[model samples]
Target: SELSEIHSALKEIEELESDNAGAEAPKNLAGAIKVQVDRVIRAYRTLLGMSGHAQEVLEVGENPDEEWKNVWLLLRRDLQKSMPRGSELEKAWHEAFNVDAEVAFEAALEVRDLAALMLVGVRYPFAPAALRATKASADLAFAEGQRALAAKGYSALMALEPFQSVSRQDLALAAIKGYLCTRELGWRKAEGEFKSWIDANPAAAVLWGEERKPIGALLLDFEKAIPSFDTLELQLGESLVSMPMATLAGQPSKAEPKNLETQAWPSLKIKGPLSPRTSYAMKNLLEVEVSPVIPTVTPTSILVNTGEALYGFDFLSGKSLWGDGVRLEAPRDAFHYSEQDPNLILTAARWQDLVIAPLENPLSKSTDAPKAKSSFGGSVFSHFPVVRRALVGVDQASGNILWTLGGQYRLRSDQASLPDLEKRIAVTSFFTLTVVDDVIYALGTTRENESQLHLVAIDPAQGKPMWSVLLGAGQGESNMFGNPMRDAMPGIPVVAEGVLYVQSNLGAVMAVEIASQRVLWVSRYEALPRPFTRIRSTAYRKVTHANGAPILTRDKKGNLLLIVAPTDSRFITAFDAESGEVRWRTQTENAQ
Candidate 1:
C-alpha cells in the first residue's frame, strides 16, 4: 500500500507541476513530498531489502552512438552524488532554463581552482566541474584561436558523455566546437563530419547558433523561436519525366497504394470490428473524407492504436499476434517494430498540448491582406480538440505496457517538471514509425518564422532524443492534410542510402542526410496554399495531398530516382535522387 501510494503521489505531483510550468511549487508541499518519498524508500529497503532494481544501463563504449546514449544514464547518477542538493546551481537545474551558452561556460571558467580540484582527485568524468569547466575551457580556446588545445579539450569533453538537458547542452557545444577545431586543422574528411554535426544536430547549431539561454531546449523545443530565413525550398526543372509508374524499376503499380480504404482486396475479408473510430487523416488522399492510420502494417498483419488499444493479426493464418489489443491513452500514428528486437513495441504520442496556428499573412505588409482568423470571426472558425498521447514501449507478446517515457519513467533525460514531457506528442504525429540501425527517426511540426517540419532521432530504450533538426516546410499548421484539426506535421520520412525522402503534403519533397540530419535538397513540385485553405473551402484551388508516397529506387546503372505520380495527374515526375534534378515528366496511360 505504501508503494502504491508513492506511485499515486508521484503522478499527482507530475499533474500539479504540469499545471504550472513557469511557477514555483509551494515549499511546504515540496518538503512534505520529499519526506514521504524518503520514508517510503527507507521502509521498502528495510522490509524488502530493496526498493527496486532496473536493468543496469550500458557503459560508455567505443561506439560514438552508444556513448551518446549511456551518457545521460551515468551523468544523472554522478550529478546526484556530486552536487549538494540544495545548492543554487542544483536549484537552477530543477527549473526550466534558457541560459546563454557563453554565460554557462563563463561560470565554469570562473572556477579558477584547478589545483584545488586536482587535490579533490576529480578526473574527466561527468562531474559538473569536469564537464562544464572543460567544455568552457575548450570553447574559450576555440574563441581565442587555440586550435590544438581546443581540439584536445573538445575530444576529452566529447568522451565525458552527458546526462539531462543541461549537461547535454555542454556536450553539444563541445561536439560542434570540436568539429570546428578539426576543420581549422584542414582534415578534409573530418571537417565535413564536423560541419555535418552542426547541420544534423539542431542543438549544435541552429538552436544554439547564438550564445543565449534556452540553449538546452532539446525535446522541449515545442515552440522554438526562429530567425526569418528563406526556408530554402528547391526548384523543380521544367523538364518532364518520360518513364511511366508501372514501368519504374522496383515499383509494381498494382501492388502499391493497396489499402483497405483506397482499394478493395477481393480475397481479403474483414473478420470483425477493430477501432471505435475506423477513419483517420491520410496526406496522400485529401480527396477522401477519411483513411486508416496504422503505425505498423506488414503483409501478414497490421498494428494500429489510437491511445485506446493495440493489436494485429497474422493474416495468412488468422492468428492474432496482439490478441486482445493493449489499451492506450489515445490513438497514435507512430509505431516502431524491429526484426532484430521482435519482442518489443515502441509507441510515442502527445496529449492536450498548446499550438498557436499561424494565421494567413500575419506578416503581410498590405493592410488589405486577409486578417480573418485572428480578427472578429476567429472564434467561430476555430475548434480546439483534445490533444494528448504517450511515449511508451509495449510487450509485443503480452500486449502490455512495458515502459513509459516521462513522469517517473526511469530512462528520462532529466527530472524536470516539463509540461508535455509525458504526453510525448510530436508537431505532427508519426505517420509511419522508422527504426534504422536501432535508432528511431520521427517527425514533429515546429512553429517558428515559417511552418517547418522537425525531425528527431530517438533511442527507444532510453526515450532520449539523439539529435534533431528542421526537415522542411509546411509545419505548425493544418495545411499538410487540409484537416480541420490543424495539427501540424510534414510528410512521412522515408530513409534510403543515408537519405531521408519526405513528402510534405503541401507540394514539396525533401531529401535529408540521415547521418547528419541535414536537408540535402528540397524540391517543390507545386505552389504552397494560402493559410486557412480548408475552412474557407476556396473553389478550384489545388491541394498538395493529391500526391503519392515517395518511390526511391536505383536503375541498373545505379542512379537513384525519387518519383511521384499523383492520382489526379497524368504525368509521372522524376527527380534525380542524388541532386534533386528533374529527370523527366511523361504522361501515363491513364491521363486525366
Candidate 2:
C-alpha cells in the first residue's frame, strides 16, 4: 500500500514535468515525492537489515551528505536480497518506468540518489531489464531538459554494446547540450566534444535548424580563443563549404547560354594531364581508380578507398579523419606499384556516413585478356581467376563497415544449358555506385552475356535493394590483343537532371528516367575495334586498363550532352540528353 502510494506520487510528478510546468513545479513535485520515497526506503531498509544507513538521509531531507551515497549502495543490495522476487517495490519500479518515465526518473533519483551515488561507484544492474529502466529514466530527464542527467545516462548506455545503436545519436546530441549548459569543466573539453560530434555526423552539424547559427557562433568564439590551429582550420573550412558557390567565387560565373548553337571542334585539345603532374604516386591515390573518370570531389574532406581500406581525410590538414588501415583486408601489392600498374580498388562514392567502394583482384598483374589457345593444343591458355565484386558501404566517421554488397561472378556450369557454359566466366570487376535522390544505383553483370547488364538500385539508408532492371544487351570488350574478352562497355553511370546515362563496354549508351526507372532511349554504336588489333610488344601503351566511361557535359545551350569515346578508337559521339538523339560525331587520328 505504501509502495503504491509512493508510485502514485512519483507518477504525478512526471505528469507535471511532461506538461512542461514551471521550473519551480518540478522541484516542488520532487520535494513532495522525495518525502514519500524516504518513508518507503526506511521501511524497506529495516526489513532488509539495513537500518541506520539512510536514517540521516531521510532526516536531512534532499540535502543528503556524501555518506548517503554509500548508504544507498548497501541499501540497494540488501533491499534486492531481502525483497521477494515479485515484491511490491519491484513491481512498482517496473510499472513506474513503463507507464510514466518521469515517475521512474524521480523514484530512481530519490532512492538511489543517481548523481551522488554515481560519484560513489553505485550503479544500477547492467542486465538488459536494468538497462531499459535506466534508459527510460534518462530519456525523461532529457525531455525535462536535464542535460547533465541525460549525459550520464548516455555515457552508461554507450558502454553497453546492445544499447549503443539506440543511444549513439541521442548521446551525441545530449553531449552537445551538456557542454553548452555547463562550464565547470574547461571549455576545451566541451569544444573538442562538440567538434567530434560534427565529424561523426557531418550532416547533423546543422540539425538544430534556427539554433544552428547560434551553435556556429559559439564554435567561432571557441575557435578564436582556442590555441589549436587544427581545430580553427577545421572550423574555417566548414564555414567556407556552407557558403554559396557565388560567394566563394566573388562573382557568379556565367551560366551556359540557353539557346546558343552547338559547335564542333576538330579534336580534343591536350592542354595538360588531368592531374598537374603526369606521374601519379600509386600509394597516395586512394581517390583515383582504374577507370579514367575522375574522383568525386567533396568540398571539405577527401574520401578514398585503396581496396584494402577506406580512408577519410581532412582536405585542408591532410590528416586522416578515420580509416580501417590497421585492419586492412588486402594490402596493396608492392609489385604493382613498382610496375606503375593501375590500383584495382576503386572508391565509388562518399557522402557523409555512406561510402561506396569496390575491391577487385589486387594480385592480377594485368587486366589484359588471356591469349587464345594455339591450334592442336600446342599451348593452352591459363584459366582466368574468378572475378569477385567488392562493392561495400563504410561509415566514414568511424571507419566501421556498414554493409557489403559485392560477390564473385559465378554460374552453375554443372547444370549448364549449352549457352551457359559458352558464356560463363568468373570475371571480377568493380562497378561504380552512384547515388541519385538518396537511391543507390550500381551496374551489375551476368557471366551469361558480356553485352547484357543490370542496373541495381539500393536504399543507401539501409543497404537494401529497391529495384533491379536488366538494361538489355549492349556491347562487348576485347583485350589489347584485339581478342574478345567481354562485350559491353562498363561505363560509370552518370546522372544529369534526374536522368541516368549508362554505357556498356562495347558502346551502347542508354538514358533512364530516375523517378520511373524506365529506359528513356537506347543508342548503339560501334565503339570497340571490329577485328583484332595486335598490340605490338612495346611499352608505349604502358598499363592496359581502359574504361570507356560516358561523359556528361552541358552543351552550349545548357542541355546535357552525353559524350562517349569508343574503346581503342578515336571516334566520339555526343547525344542529346532528353531525347537520346545524336548531336554530333567526330573522329581524330591520334586521340583516344
The best candidate by TM-score is 2
The parts of candidate 2 lying over 4 Å away from their true place are 1-293, 306-309, 321-345, 361-378, 409-430, 449-451, 474-484, 526-560, 565-567, 590-592
Which lDDT tens digits does candidate 1 get at residues 494-562? 555567776665556678887666889978664334332333332222222223346776564346798
Per-residue CA lDDT of candidate 2, range 471-576, in tens? 7764544333332355332455666545778766445678887668789999876554434222221111211124424667765434678887755445678888
Local distance difference test, candidate 1: 0.43
Give residue 571's lDDT in candidate 2 (0 to 100): 68
TM-scores of the candidates are: 0.38, 0.41
Local distance difference test, per candidate? 0.43, 0.47
lDDT of 2 at 387: 39
